[model samples]
Target: MSAASLPGVRLWTGRVLEDLRAGRSCLCLLPRTPAGGADAAAVLDELLHELGDFVLLPAPGPADAAAPRGAGLPGPPAAAAPPPGGPWTDTAPVLDYDDGLSAFGVGPRGGGPVPSDAASAAGRDTPAAHGPAGGGEPGPSAAGRAPERGRPTAHDLADRVLKELGAAAPGADSGPAAGVDGLLHRLTDGSGAASRVVVVRGWHEPVPAAAAELLRRLAAAVKAAGLPPERRPRLLVLAGPSGLAAELPEQVARDDVAVHWWWGVHGRLDTATVVAMARPPAAGRAARHQLLEAVAQATVVEVCGPFLDLAERLAAEWDGSPDTLPPQLRRLLCDEGLLPGVPDPDDAARTVPAPRGPAPGAALPAPAGALREHWDRGLADRWDGRLRHWPGAAARRDPRTQETGAPVWDWEWEHGVRTRIWLAQNTALLPLLDEAREAFTEVIRSRSRLPLPDLAARYGPRRDGVPGPRPGTAAAPGSAAALAGMELGDMWRAHIQGDARLSQPEADRLRTLWRSRNSLSHREALDSPRLEGLADHLTR
Candidate 1:
């Protein structure tokens, strides 16, 4: 296919430019036997036209070419290429247009290379136009004198690009859509850091606990990196099979801790997804729309992955200066229609301290149901009252300023949200309490099944219609007393004899579990008849 016949040339070129400047190599694998105008040919043609210095050449047949095409050049139109004897010398950008090209090799480009282990990997969605030169490993050949990021293999470029694209940073790599095993690393290790893992895992798994563990790892990593996690919410790239979509947030919440996370994930990468993601809008929190708008922006071409990466790098990127201002200014705070420190936004701010608005005489639009409620919170100081907070973190209006305020120095970042979600995803409660209770019940069959709490966050009482933290869950002020009051031993004995129809020996084991659970929750051990029953049950 000739350059005139290709489509998507613009996007292809943009990706190429992005890779080239990022110091990544690339290739376009073309098919020699015209498979009758495939999409790849059109893309190749577009790339050829966009690329001035590149030239077309016949791929080297098993036998030598009469004149040898793709290579053997001062490297295409000298007018546009890098000039003589400078930092950019040996490095002139060249696009080899290969006719009879079964594949086009971008040459370790920051592009997708064909799979080296295609057999084991199964489906190859987009096959590379060309395998690397010499076809040794993958990407570009290593005949060059200097060794680069790797040993200058044909794959270094693609590997690097995938490394960035396919990274699984803690919170970043995790999601409901991604499976634990679905994340496959195509590149070698010791590449650049993932910044954060962005797995696309979701809650479709029956065992929610597995998903929680993944989130737990992410929080751990953020703390270790010393990033202002409270301020900067990192991106989590998530792509999962359809219908299983809603499972992402639900699974994370099983552990309860995931409810407070500051992580964000991508659910759309195409226009269709963009439209589908945005709908008539749900009647939930107004801030949810803000979250939706951000994801929707990422779905269309309006945003690019590398640009997002760059933005995040800038947001979280520090010169290691102690004077580093909060990334929140970049991530959230906007001044006069611009985020702080942004050149264009800063320039606009210099001219006007506030954002442009409706004409002076025009009335502002009235807010809606949920929106009105949220606005009212910041406005007249009323609570719709769905939110629960760490005692001190709850907001209060300043008496003088009349603005919504939090008495605490720091309000909870979304980290707590993610934590709550994490607990839900794990189908878990606190280790010492729920875990021991469940283990004891299963271990002691003779006892009545006292029906432990239903892996839900709120099990015990309702504080003002909302479920408060129950006995085994992460309790607040009165947690310890609540568990003791349940009278688990007597309750279990009755349950076993009456409900489970168990004898005294079986009831004894469950009695032990009740005591052990209480002891563990208080960070102690038990040695009495009840605890000994549990010990005996475990041994048996």
Candidate 2:
């Protein structure tokens, strides 16, 4: 699509052109996505053709994975010959503007002759030698000229631009300050052409300290460049996802700095826009509206193709059949097949399956309901009792430390509280455990006031005045051997089976985890691995 056709693209280009006309500098944040970046570059290309003597700097380090691959230039290269030195000659500073404009074969505003490619014309200074004397357009084919070797990194681009400005090195012993000063002078001083434009991308990458410093300095330098307003240069800095924008001073809040943000495909293409995109531009409203809901449901704009394909398949499959399929089931199919980043059929087949059945040679395992109920009630009672009767549970008073001596908390008490809080905050308990615990509690609570479902089930419901289970016969599930009167380790072993389950080595691991968990809850010791192990067991 043409740049003007996209709302964001139009806004971006319009503001940039407005800034150039006003002799102001702007910072534009291109989206990190492929489409957004491409549109941003297209806006720049339009700017280049409209206003010459500009420099394009690539981002430092490896190109982002989302960036477009295998490029010539981000936009179409120059196709026509450039004019000889003309109107801006008087305004040209140290090196004439024509000399720099030739680099990209761009020309001045209002449709002037475009310069020859400076890379090719680098060896040959004047256009007369390469083109007709009367200024007829250069006839040499683009293939005749040498092409750029590969994508240039940010540092490399910075060095080239500095060299172009006649300030490659600030002076051997003068240091980075001098180099920065020299480059700034080239941009702002009466040495470079008025209204020069420069684009520096990828400042967020691991660029050299010196290069990074130069970019940061530009934030402050922009105001200075526009001091006189008439001679200001237009600077556009494009940052990526590294959050480099946060590292540098913000421009969005600054009155002198104009900031534009591109928030990727979702930001620009909404539900209605996407539906329109699915059909030919000239299609009728009825045709467009027919697929509007389906297109709107697509999770990602790039998935429009797959979504349309899925719709087509569904229609063909049910052509002569009854249309009795539930909408929810069709939605599930769309979610699975048309959502961005959703695994394909091949991927789903390759994925490791969840545990589905009891291990071989084991009796049909007892329903999770009984075991879950026992664990929930038993663990909660143990945790409550442990908290109440924990060591240092009673505060000890130190007369010297407390004037009133009402109840001075000792270091032991303080340590206990702190350690308990830390463990509670940092433990990596699995969500599934909490879910199971809650389900079990709700089931038992709904049945009666008794905590353990097994006890209630076994005793055949409480009589109006009957006491709870006899203390001697009952044991909390926290006890290593109380679960179904089977060893906790053995119960775990019997519950899980197959190659996917942990081996015998893990039984000892389970014992250690159990011991450590108890100690942690009792505030006896602090161990991160114990918490991690518990998490692992629950998740597995």
Candidate 3:
């Protein structure tokens, strides 16, 4: 795919579009297609979406237009729109010049501008989409404005974006999915300090200028709201559609966007990761946000893979993403949402404790594949996983160490970017954790029961915002007394565990303690010690 000059790519755009027709603001990835010659903007538009409701991307530079189009690549559609009041229309696939406007020849319904030229003369080889968040020109796209940036901008197109997402908007840093609303509200009202993000992943270039314009607005809004660069919202424009590599970095970047999980395909929400994703804080523990920005902006040069690993440590957070995430980290951060209150960027660096230095082979790519052998431990870690991208097999890594006697733990995907299990604890145990995750997913999916308020049924009038043993008390201590021993033991053990994922020594120690505390075992049923030992030996 990379070998092609103007490589047109296809990627799952996700189902966020449902939020659009429902009247909610959203961000989406519009398909990108290059046109022949250096005409830059859209000379002709393509009718997309079965209902003809979709948008288009900009034309590629002339050099790229010479590349081979996909075999059987559908030709462009007629310049057109849907029935006057009808929903979008189309059954056949369509490709056209992304001029950056709506089928209505306007900005998305009720928004301003993000700074895109109607002709989509937007800069960058790639452009992002703002959905309805870009408040300018109501979706006329770059023809009238810029793609909506997460923050406010000073440029003409970006100006429309600033008018919307100011300080007064409801600010959502992170939390419930509803937080997205707060972010949108804050973008439109307040100083725009609240961070939000829009992500675009596709290999096709000539990104619709509307996407860039939207980015400008977001940037402008951030400034209007006094958002320091560290807390600014982000719009991550990916290179292609199909591969999952973009998801991990997009999710874990120092500047992260919220992830919306939806049900897809037979019994498998977990079955597919629309975009490989996870998350991280905007600033590292030390609060060196500048360093983070440098990495995010792709400005740093890693001297070696370890240097990049060292950077991840020095920053106190992994704002700039590394290529490979140990499997053990698949869900390690389900609870650590970025806190709402912004911390002083400088203070983060000052207060952050020193790091433990880079992990061994930290800069090295995973055990197998040409990337491992061909990769140069040059002055900096280029993390080919980030710099180079492909589709399908190449993009979705199938790493396996080719070394004659490599340990199973050292096995690598033969086709994708490679990396060692960055974290020592993940060594030789990712498969087990993956299995557990799969099983746990199956268990929950087996039933369609509502997942919340299992105790709601026992609720009554609250003396204070809690349920009481008697009347008028929210969560009375007395009502919870029967479970006291269990609580105490759980607290004690959890405190000791400290999320190390436990080892045989720790389990053995626990077992000795359990045996010595027979009374504790009979009363508290401390059978966990043995189970812990079993788990450690079997998996770790």
Candidate 4:
């Protein structure tokens, strides 16, 4: 797929374009990860081609014999050409502007060759001699010439930049000498119709002291210059890793030089976009949505390149089935911790079942009645008051459309508040609620004059003031003997408040706990202050 179509690439490129158009220079840092390196490079190439109309002057490599040419600077050769029968070919055209126009006013704005006298005065060869028609070769004149191969110096960079702008060779026209000042003069001279984009590759390498100083000066000069936004030149430095920004001179920072980082988490692609890219043409919308959600949950970390690679692999083998995920995709999700791994049949059979009630001799009884039913049939069936393999509740039903058709899972809501509440209950609030229940039970047992069994029998779930058995009688299902079966909500409403010893403020404190308990049971969470207050009250 084209890099421009990738969400991360599009976002970064759009921001850079905005900076350039606003006359701000940029320093683009490529991803340090090996997998992302190729993706960053592809995006850079795409951006360069996309800005074809701009004066794109790639800084010359150290080995070039002649000065850099306009729209034809060869920074480096491709590592290898695509194979003839490969799935893709490398036939994309290079960025080449019309050569008839000179960088200065030697030719008409429409189009014409540079005047012979003007070309010679500037020490420039005819446009044809500078490079081939398509910006491919150095032409016959430069073919046999060889230059020292090492990092280009600050002077070398400045000279080429000035020449590309059609400024006379440094010191030729009594202009500023070939250096940062001279280059700035030409760029801010207000001569060219198009903005200049000077893209310097291989910036991850140690920059020469002179080159670094030159860059600082150019950045400062561009900012200080009051040229219109469209007329200001932009400098884009491309590097492989990060931390290089610190090495740059402080002037670059002071001027607010835009730094675009494409690495690590910063480079992650949108999950939906990646899924779309990897989806088979024949896949149904439901299949696409499912895959998108699975990927979003699976990729909790920033690893866009590897994730995209896996998605492509899945696409190649996908059968376009909508009912279930492809086997390979399922295994991938399992490995990513999104789905549960395959369980051994013997282990599954031997696995202990979840506890259905409080342990024997506990301070309080397990919940009964509506609260018990809710715990078993509601919370347990959904999230079990804990986030397990999926870390999310089942897809929620949309109330608005439930009457018209079979309920459909609202994936959006599932990913939103539902997931958040589930996380809070499992991680922060549920443990405190459990503690509050035990504390409330102890307080009641210690403070009240009435026996716990009699209190429960009088106030706990039963029919219309009709007592089953006296406190000392044999315990029946609905008798006071079942005090242990009442949960915090039932005990608070049915028993705790019935005790006259509980002061109004104390009763109110217990009420707070009851409300919080209900909120959690209904899939909501108390705010931090309430939770903290609840904990403090329990400790007291």
What ordering of candidates by TM-score runs from best to worst?
Answer: 4, 2, 3, 1
Judged by whole-model lDDT over C-alpha atoms, candidate 4 comes out at: 0.44
Record all residue pairs in model 2 with backbone atoms less than 3 Å apart, i.e. clashing: 82-114, 82-115
Question: What is the lDDT ranking, best to worst?
Answer: 4, 2, 1, 3
What TM-score does each of the candidates earn? 0.17, 0.34, 0.20, 0.40
lDDT per residue (tens digit) for residues 1-540 in model 3: 021111111111222323222222223321122111111111111112321322222223563466454321222223212233221111111112223232222332224343445333322112222224655333322222232322112122232233333322111222111122233334444343333333332233322232333433343344445644444455433321211222332322222122221101011111011111222444433434433333332211221122222222223333334332222122122122211122233532223232232232121112122222111111111222332211111112113753221224323321121222122113222343334333322222222132212222222223465533334334533233211222222222432544223345644544443342332323322122332332443343
State how far residue 443 of model 1 sits from its true place (Å). 5.1
Best by TM-score: 4
Weakest ten-residue segment in model 4 by summed lDDT? 87-96
Per-residue lDDT for 331-418 in model 2, tens only? 4344543222212334322232322333432111111222222211111001111211212112344567642112233455344434
RMSD of 2: 25.6
Steric overlap count per candidate: 91, 2, 119, 1
514, model 4: CA deviation in Å?
22
Candidate 2 accuracy as TM-score? 0.34
lDDT of 3: 0.27
lDDT of 1 by residue, 1-540 (tens): 232232222433454444333322222212121111123324433444554432122222442333232311111112222223221222212222213221322122233233343321321222221223365543222111121222222122222223345444312332211121122121112233332222211211222222233343333333433444232212221111111222333333321122311101111132223233333444444544433333223321121111222223322332211112222222322221221111232332123222233242222112222322222222111111112111112233455664433223223322332232233212212333445555544433333243434211223344466544443555542334333333345446446445446557656656665656555455342323433344345445
Better of 3 and 4 by lDDT: 4
Worst 10 residues of 3 by lDDT: 262-271
Off by over 4 Å in 1: 1-405, 408-438, 446-540
